[model samples]
Target: MLTIWGRRTSSNVQALMWCVGELALEFQRHDVGHRFGGLNTDGFRKLNPNGTIPVIQDGERPPLWETGPILRYLASAYGEDDFWPRDPTRQAEVDKWAEWAKINVAMAFTVPVFWRVVRTPEAEHDHHAIEKALTALESTLAIADAQLSEHAFLCGSCLTLADIQLGHVLYRYYDIDISRTSLPNLRRYYDTLTERPAYQTHVMISYDELRRN
Candidate 1:
């Protein structure tokens, strides 16, 4: 069984777990980071000196840290053709979007929008900064919306690793309090993801603990 170390409430962890669930991979997960706080231990540090969550050990081959690499490792090992295409060109096509989502969409939303709105205390919220970040984030979402309009998923008609990279962000994006520009196709795409059991199980979770922190 695959062993994972990360807190469930963590967005990165949620993404990894969702992909594992979608692939029907048997795995055991340990809650760490955030309120759980196992990040600083000597053992955890040996596993990952970077001290980040969502690290995985696949039967002692080695511990893998960083959400992106761990995810690609899983996709390469377990994902089916539609999920992770074998052709280099096709793979690159999907990978580009996955990278794009990671760099552009996820990065833009997490610290900029989500952290600002949810993690910060309400009275101290930076309205100008939040608005600026949200506007930037929405511009990127518009690109996804246009692509989703033509295809059911991010990279194509069927779900791919790109979807795993991008889709996990939508739960917090839609649920959070913010002024959002209407993107019907993006909304439809997210709604479709909600119907997936993996998406619902791993991504749609309570942030009450996060709020209390």
Candidate 2:
């Protein structure tokens, strides 16, 4: 069995969890980081010197950190090349979308939304920052909407690693209260994602608590 260290609420951890369920791989998960707070301890550091959540120990192999790397490793090792692409060009395309989500979409939209709803105190919340993030996010989503109009999934016909990576972030965006932007294609794609049992079980959650605090 594999051992994973991270709290359930962490988005990175959620990505790993969703992957495990999608692959039907059995594993053990330990709650750490954030309110759980074992990340800084020496015992935890030995596994992951950076003290980040979602580190995985695969049998006797050294533990792996960083959510995207972990996802790629898992797909390569156990996903029968279905989660990831085997063809060089297809792989490159998947990698591009995954990287795009991390840098462009995640940084500009997801982080700010998460911070505003989950981390920031209500009294001190930065409305301007939130609005700016929302604007940037809406614009970026328009691109995704157009892309999705041509294909059912991010990297092509099938649900590849790119979908998994972007879907995790989309969960956050879908939950956030934003304007009525014309994103019919993105909306349809998101609806399809929710219909999957794996997504419903692992990724879907109420934003009420995150918003309330």
TM per prediction: 0.98, 0.92
Residues 64-168 of candidate 1 have per-residue lDDT tens digits of: 999999999999999998999999999999999999999999999999999988998898899999999999999999999999989999988899999999999
| Index of the highest-lDDT prediction | 1
lDDT of all the models against the reference?
0.94, 0.81
After superposing candidate 2 on the true structure, give the runs of residues whose Cα lies further than 4 Å from its correct spot: 206-212
- Model 2 / residue 52 / CA error / Å: 0.6
Candidate 1 lDDT: 0.94
